[model samples]
Target: MVKWIVKFRNERSHLWAKVVMAIHSGGRSFTTIPIKNSISGVWKNIVQLGKGSSLKLSDVQNRLEVKMGCGDKIFFWLDKWVGDYSLKDRFPDLFAVQTDKFCLVQQRYSLTNGEIVWSWGGESPATHTDMAETWAECVKLLEGVKIEKKSDMWLWKQEDKQEVFKVSDLRSELDGMDLIPET
Candidate 1:
């Protein structure tokens, strides 16, 4: 139920398409003929439009606006694992001994362009002996550099320069916190 705004780089287009198709198709549970047919129909439409005609990450906010109508629930898929780093830091006494293997982490983030960005880190979580260095490296890569902030909103720059991403309606109490967990 955790939502994500996925953004895929050009090289990862195939994965992006698969995920979108999965979303529209109800992932692994769509089996009714009508649902299947509807999904197939949508896929055909997308395919006919071609990649160039397809939506970009920049279109996601507007697209969500349309699709969600007045609903407050946002939808997204997580292709990676994420951990509660804040919890780990805040209650080290409670979480310190929990192995990385037990910590769940989110794998994907949605960019404004409608693409999914994969986490850039090692596949496995950092071991107990290497947790500090691993966590530092992951934070360095995922933390956005603050660019501007107002009373109600803040603009931050992602590590990827080619894609300019911003976060509005700041809500840290929500899960994910605009960061990808390093596994």
Candidate 2:
């Protein structure tokens, strides 16, 4: 189930991925969409697996890492495109004050007169020292990350050399796991 979702994320241009996105997520990001009760078959099963009491959505997300390029597809705060974790997780205080939580990385910054101009979504009040410090740290991290013309890539965190997705590996992993807990 995690493998399917991971494959969908990594191969957004693939026909199967496109069909799943259109039918399951309604052309929206798979991460943001809610799984409906009416949903059936593979999509429903995958969604249910991710939403299981024991298997969290973060558990699946944590398996993939993003390398931001054009930054259009990568969620600015939600995606683990920069650093070890998402900015929302790393800077909780700033995330709480963020106006647009779903804003893309490209939306946060612009190229103007050959310089990168950052336009933050919300104002961080000066009185909150924690938020202010967090905001500065987040900005400092962003400064070093240059948005380029290349397409963004999502690599499997478990893979050492390539961004390849193998169903056999996932099958072996599942075969070793105890899916049901003895209550």
Candidate 3:
């Protein structure tokens, strides 16, 4: 049997919760034990393990590695594939960790299928307008858009319209608005 500890901290409350799971290599499952308090630093088996059998340390570590790896994969997929446009545009406070390079705000239309696109700020109005129309058409056709990052360009779904617009263009629009700051 092996022991593995997982800890989570609440940023707002500053509270911590720790879970200790014991795994048995032979059984391929965790031991049912309640790790109520950390002060004692003892492993008390809360569940019966068939009359005297307990988990070994090696088993616990293996289980922990497997679980942690699975968690990391899921997190990677969510960050790479999902786009929360409203949150990206309106509530930076809510998602403090999302970066502009990784995500985009949901647009009015969804991109069903298209190639990725990129645009920098301060492009000509004709170019910007064309890009915007293309993007809007993409949204209309695909129903969703995903902004993907590459070494030199951002990729996104779009239609073959004469016009095209990018996130940088949208930022320019926002800047032009000159919205008042909240007091």
Candidate 4:
């Protein structure tokens, strides 16, 4: 599941991933595809794995954070591009008010006269103190980010030096967990 997801994100030209994405979600980000809409067993399973609230899925998902480069493909609120947590999880109040939940990091900001101008989704900025404070923090978090002219990449958080995903590593980690119970 993780392999397929990684392929979908990293290897855009991969035949299997391309075919699955073409048929299942019509080239949309796999994560954005609603589980209810999925028809194929593999597609359904993939969506469930990505969206599931299970501890196993959550733990694995957290390790696969996006490293922003171009920022076109990385989701602003949904993907963990800013820090360890997604903006949605970090600032639920601001997320609740966002106009586009699935907006890209590139869409949230613009290069205006050599300065970065952030535009959070909404008709107008939040006025409520709680949301306002959350908005400020979110902006501050992004102040240091500068999108470069390279494709977005995913980093496996567990791997310190390599920053690469290995099936063996994942297998070992899963094996270490108490997956099977004595009956």
Candidate 5:
């Protein structure tokens, strides 16, 4: 239900966007982007359920895989667009010296008439000692990727590539994970 609501948060109705902002923001608006502990009446119960439940919101987010088309919607460093990790998470040393961490995949990469070009924010991380090695691997990893003109989507990684997200599938996947510590 939360993912369904969030999927329509930006593209659908104005009221839905407002509600999403309220709920996802934890009642706090633009002022506090990361802080929790403050939730409005509408989402207080949901937040509480998340806290008491075995599956966490962060866990679900970590398992999400993005199908990039234009790449405008997905964050470059923050979102998990690659196989299993975000670029920042996959390459922390290189990310530390990055010129523009916020640059989206669309901005950093482009396809011109069948040719794929990666701009990489036009900066080379010369300061890092492992820059040469990491950059080469990063380049090779990005070489196969291309940006097509289509809508992006957040796919549940537990399902097949063509499969649509089902709450049952997500629940089962989450249930399979070890939520309790064994002594």
Candidate 6:
């Protein structure tokens, strides 16, 4: 999706990329051509191809590691980001004391003098004994973080260390799965 136009060229150099992009962006429908009610078998197959992968739960969970660029999409508490664990798991006490458990990465942290801090500004639960320790730990992790002006990238934490999502990689993953042949 980062380079949708150039990336989707086929063997014949036909630019079906637009159609593919539209399918992904426009609710996986026949958006390249206006469709009132019905869909063609070809379109159905195309849509099915996109949804046909049988990803395992562990594999799916492993894939949610977001490469935080600007902290736009990654959920702060719920997602696994830092130290191979979610904030909710790492700091259970803090999560229990948190005002908003569903906050994004950007919401829970703030940049102060080029250092990231665990800040809920108005009413931080730092007064509590347990929360103070949790805040300290969070601050430790946050201080090491470096955010740049870039889009947040949701990555699969499998063999893709570079964090680029590829359909071929998913196909390869599916190929390894043992399946009964259709008669």
- Highest lDDT model number: 2
- The segments of candidate 1 whose C-alpha lies over 4 angstroms from its true place after superposition are 1-39, 51-127, 130-132, 147-183
Tens-place lDDT per residue, model 4, 1-183, is: 666666566764468655665566433333533233646587668656645533355566666766678787677887777777778788877877777776778788888898888886965677778777778888999998877879888766674643667678767776776756779
Candidate 5's residue-wise lDDT over 25-53, tens digit each? 43212211122455455445554555566
Write model 6 residue lDDT over 15-70, tens digit each, in one string: 46345434443332212122223445454453343334455333454554566786
What is the TM-score of each predicted model, taking all chains together? 0.23, 0.66, 0.16, 0.68, 0.60, 0.61
Please, what's the RMSD in Å of model 2? 5.2
Candidate 4 weakest lDDT stretch, 10 residues: 26-35
The Cα error of candidate 3 at residue 76, in Å, is 14
Q: Write down the lDDT that model 4 would get.
A: 0.68
Error of 1 at 150 (Å): 9.0
Question: Model 5 Cα RMSD, Å?
Answer: 6.1
Q: What is the TM-score of candidate 1?
A: 0.23
lDDT ranking, high to low: 2, 4, 5, 6, 1, 3
- Considering lDDT, which of the candidate structures 4 and 6 is the better prediction for this target? 4
| Clash numbers, per candidate | 26, 0, 26, 0, 0, 0
Give the Cα lDDT of each candidate.
0.31, 0.69, 0.28, 0.68, 0.59, 0.55
lDDT of 3 by residue, 43-79 (tens): 3342223124333332322222111111111122112
